[model samples]
Target chain A: MIAILNAYRYRMLIPVNRTTRVLAGLTAALLLALVWAAASGALGISLWEVLRGQEDPFSVQVWWQLRLPRLLLGVAVGAMLAGSGAAMQGLFRNPLADPTLLGLASGAGLFVALWIVFFQDSGAGSLYGQFAAGFLGALCVCLIVFGIAKRQGGGSAAVMTLLLAGLAINTLAGAGGGVLAFIASDEQLRQLSLWGMGTLTNALWRTTALALVLIAAALWLLMRSARELDLLQLGEATAHAAGLDASRLKHRVVVATSLGVGLCVALTGVIGFLGLLVPHCLRLWLGPSHRLLLPASMLGGALLLVVADTLARTIAAPAEIPVGLLTSLLGGPYFLYLLMRRNRAC
Target chain B: MLTLHQAGLTNTPAIAPLDGTIRPGELLAIVGPNGAGKSTLLSMLSGFRSAEQGELHLDGKPLRAWPITELANRRALVAQQELPGFDWQTNELLSLGSNPSKSLVAALLDDLDITHLAKRSVLSLSGGERQRVMIARGACQLLSRCSPTAKEGGILLLDEPTSALDIGQQQRLMRQLRSWATQHHMAIVCVLHDLNLASTYADRVWLLHQGQRIDHGLPNQVLNPATIAKIYAAELQRIEGGTHGKPLLALAP
Candidate 1:
């Protein structure tokens, strides 16, 4: 593992600087979070027991069947959320842009509600249908918000209009999901509620693997556009005048963000505030250069979500709270603090 | 030489079709009344906008045929307005051009008298400071394309570079740009609202009125009161043979 990491040390897209040191620190934090999460769950399997190869059937099942998949899913979902947030922030050149704030999560949730109420079936095809519908719904909301923002002239007012549009869509999607819940049968309603309050308890190895692959693909696409994103901070006309095709860059970022956020919501329901805070905090420390920001945010998000998920399951002792609830419970105040700080600075 | 043969936009004929050539080792000031297409002309020369009517040739090659990166290496533009979202340091912002070169960046900072502001956040700069930094960035961008031992001959397009600058900084910037052009055989095209500054430094002057070319010649021939009144529609008195041996115009109050 160290050898693999060492290979990556020299192959980073950006030059090695203080930001690289910050990324290394984030990686260490993520590793620590993984170990803490593996040990501190409801089943109470010690890290030492797993490391020492003690193979009691119950502990072995808890270790292999339960903790591992949940942690793996956390890593995938967290990385996707944070990476997408970083990309969205870069695309809009606004620090406040994120999947949850932009209605992507609720959009996906509304479609998932539709799948649960109308298309619920005990079959593999039905499950895939939910994922596809969720993906399409997320993409649709993203495009709608983008279209509205662009129509408002895409000037200094673009960010304001985007946030307002996102708020309206989130309210609409919430109302739609609520209506679906009102009509759902008892069993379908229970499933929909459980999905709404996100948890990694339902993670399977196959789905975890797929989510990881999708997150990695999205991160790769976002990272490829890092240099252009940096230039775009100078504004569109300047970026274009400096030889970048600004419109093409914006298009590519939008498509990549939709795919990334879509897969994340489909995988983990609505993991609110993870996307917003991970990149915003990292940008506060590392500055707005996307080259370092994207990678560091992925690691930071994985660390934050894993730690939050661990607390979620362990704090309530076996009767676990939703990981999404834990994230918002923690991240909401932090986001408010950021907004207040921005106001103070202004 | 960069030659434009009746090059102009057709969609918004705000700029009439015009012909001109920008030669190496010359500083050409484009002076005109408001809305007379000075900015449009600068946009065309910098290849930011394509002219529908005629051809623009660079080194005997068509302008549109040049790849973006290739064109970027050969030229740089300092726009009239800058609105960056981040608090990037001046040096960092300057490095975002096609080429990022440490030596070139350092030399530009020193030459443009912005060396002290190198580490300062661009967000914290005053308007004049930002304008100087932008010009320095453009110069560094042009210098980045030069071989270490070769003298670079790059085109610089400055659209109202002096608007935000104080009188002292403006004079200093123009003097340095003039010397730099002569020393490096660089071709420069600047749009100036101040007619005296145009006459004082420009090797030649191109005057436009209502998007049409009214005059193109040496500063003396272009800045006389008759032509100034004809285009600007203001009564102006001229003081000839200033310290720079060029005409200076003032309102006849």
Candidate 2:
């Protein structure tokens, strides 16, 4: 008991394991790849050579200042979104469930549209303002989803009610964003469109710091309740008989995972589907034990995002395609494949 | 070693519920038609549902005070429906029954003649095979880590152990379970639909009528044609001199 407490106090936030070994290895390779791409400006050289002076006076100022921060931002956002997706899938017992379920992405997207209209210079260039609006938007959507679902029963805790609530909120937010987009100018339109697609081009230190702290705390809270998650999959009555406070466990997980997701959405306007895709693949590899699955999911999601993000940047040289586009383009067909497979099996 | 003191489970709270006690090593069979609260009574006693009016005790201590692991270790309940999405191999499913403190589950599977199914996926098994696996799981729960002799006690709560098995398989499995109970001195509370099976297998029977337990006694006394009719709302034909002839129940048109 003493040793456990000591380990909790002193251990590295991310524990090293076979899963983590692969994660760290991939992270190193991706980080190196990202740094190399930025330094060399491997595609269109003139467009990005403005901020590379951190390492040496002669080095291009754009490489160190602009590209490195964006890379880190992608890494952080990917991990958080993936973690959120993992939690959502586990909670719903549906492989297709994602961070977008509670309307966080649409909510964040709406706020970015409204922010771009109201605030001057509120794109990737001025990230804190955008992140704040995004967080508040997600937070507000969560409250609404919670209120609507809890009144009916409880969102995401009871699978059907949660799924319905997600669908309802997602539709409402999408409609609201469409109306907002119709009213804006060409510049606002362009900014809103890119934000809707999501990017990690503007990760400032303070706001990214917020995401790191909030997400780590959230993941920690969720990880502590992994055993309860295992018992819960057995069903509520069984979980209760097994001496778990089922309602409490469900609420805790929702908060931890949702908050982690909210922070990620705030950082990178609205990344889609990593959470759903990563956990589903991980569950097939690791069994349903949350203690094993959650950590493995985090690494798997991060690796998937790294590979996807690398492709996103490299696929189109001069103009970087939004990472969310890659996820949507890739994820939808894969999701369809899984759905058909499950239907056939059933 | 189970006692439910004036326990009440009411669809409407005004109705008075039944009270009962099941002693250690006693095979108590609960018999009633559909919706007699037979399953409800079993569920309450097994800690599936909370009792409103009275307390549930295991060996004189309150049932609520026991931790989940300890409670699970002591009472092994086979629920009514088949639990789906079980991806375990047959032996692994049986091993789940083993308490962490006990020996491996191989002994029970060996005794039950399920050793050949050790590597087979439990989900792919037939109904009779599945029922046997469920029983094997409950049996393994009794002896997982330590070599628990038949003397070391535990409780076996079966809602309908032989409900799906053929006559021969049902008789074989119940006989094995009865022998295990006799050797171990553990309480066995089984909810049974078969009157003849109860008469032949159970030491005592608890008969319920419309959510009320009307009688609970030795099988011969409880299996009377009139009492059976009162609970089942049908006339029963009593046969004499059959295989282990007790009482054969026939539905009257």
Candidate models: Cα lDDT each: 0.82, 0.68
Interface RMSD values for all candidates: 1.8, 3.8
* Cα error of candidate 2 at position B106, Å: 2.2
Mind giving the per-residue lDDT tens digits that candidate 1 earns over B1-253? 7998988777664567788888878999999898888888787888778778889998788989988767877777887767676677898888886566677788888888899999998888999899898888777777776555645478988989899988899899999999879887789889999998988899999998877788999988988999898788999998877865777889999
**Chain B in candidate 2 has what TM-score?**
0.89
lDDT of 1 by residue, A198-251 (tens): 777778776777767766887788888888988878666556567777778777
Q: Positional deviation of B190 in candidate 2, in angstroms? A: 2.4
TM-score of chain A of 2: 0.77
Q: Indicate which candidate wins on DockQ.
A: 1
Interface RMSD of 1: 1.8
What is the TM-score (0 to 1) of candidate 1? 0.91
lDDT of 2 at A313: 75
lDDT of 2: 0.68
